[model samples]
Target: MGFREYRGSRQHTHAHFVLTGHTSFEDEPPLLEELGINFDHITQKTMTVLNPTKETDASILGDGDLAGPLVFCLMFGSCLLLGGKVHFGYIYGIGGIGCVSLWCLLNMMSLTGVSVWTVASILGYCLLPMVFLSGASIILSLQGVLGQILATLSVGWCSLSASKLFVSALAMHDQQLLVAYPCALLYGVFALLTIF
Candidate 1:
């Protein structure tokens, strides 16, 4: 009888909830709101990509976020696919190599080292212009003068924005052009991928 009472007391003690009010289902955020916040975050990052001259917040740029970049890469590849090109392998290969190379180069160049994921994130974010260029290729032939112009503009935009973000995040004020040179090369590859 005593052992049964002791067992009952043990069960009663273990059954109580440790978390009270905060664990309630009503406090959880709705799905749409969470999605909206994520969208807003992506938009802000894109805005940073678009505006090269504007000072970028290091926190935003240095978080080493990859979701935006992954989406951009997939979008770029998909746009190319839609345009009758199956260069997904080339895209992924170049992106991975470029990010690693840039990470190494930036770490060597800057006092503040950079993360590979950050390099990838910046490269991916900068691909926005490339995405548009790839999309434009779908609608019209990108071999003409107008296509050349668009491709040039897109490459320049991506390169400048990427270099600017890197310089800003790494605090390499004087080496913006130096940073831009390699960025131009990287984005130039994407431009070729779009054109051919």
Candidate 2:
């Protein structure tokens, strides 16, 4: 029978039928997968951030992701908030401006230029140390000698991690120091934010 004839015959049957294997039926992914938070990816990035001298896998760091960065930035802001410093706006604002500035600077300095998002991701991932420093400030006043030392170390950690990633991703082996100087300056700003 023709489709039209079958439909006409079923007109008196007001019920609707849907096939389980219909084209419209789709299996949704699990919540974790849908959220795009790859634990493995974040773990690798975090490890690299912790160990600044370690060589990063280009394929991993080159694939820019903002999830870890967003978490670190938020953590830094939250820790600062807990420490009685409400600098969420400064955190995000400095982060955005710093990422753009680094993106521009690195592009000019490297043969294989990078995108702003990639720069942002790398910088954001490196912010983990700063986040920790911010968290520490909650229990200890950062205006003293010990606090200054910790803040300096954290800034170095962030700068080294970010510079290493940027250099490896962009193949700027000869210009590591050049890349690191700006990274240090940027992270120094973040350190200043964490301190005062």
Query: TM-score for all predictions?
Result: 0.81, 0.84
Position 129, candidate 1: lDDT: 96
Off by over 4 Å in 1: 1-39
For residues 119-138, what per-residue lDDT tens digits would candidate 1 score against the true structure?
A: 98889999999999999999
The TM-score of predicted model 1 comes to 0.81
Instruction: Output the lDDT of residue 170, model 2.
Output: 91
Question: How far out, in Å, is residue 185 in model 2?
Answer: 1.0
lDDT, candidate 1, equals 0.87
Each prediction's number of clashing residue pairs: 0, 0
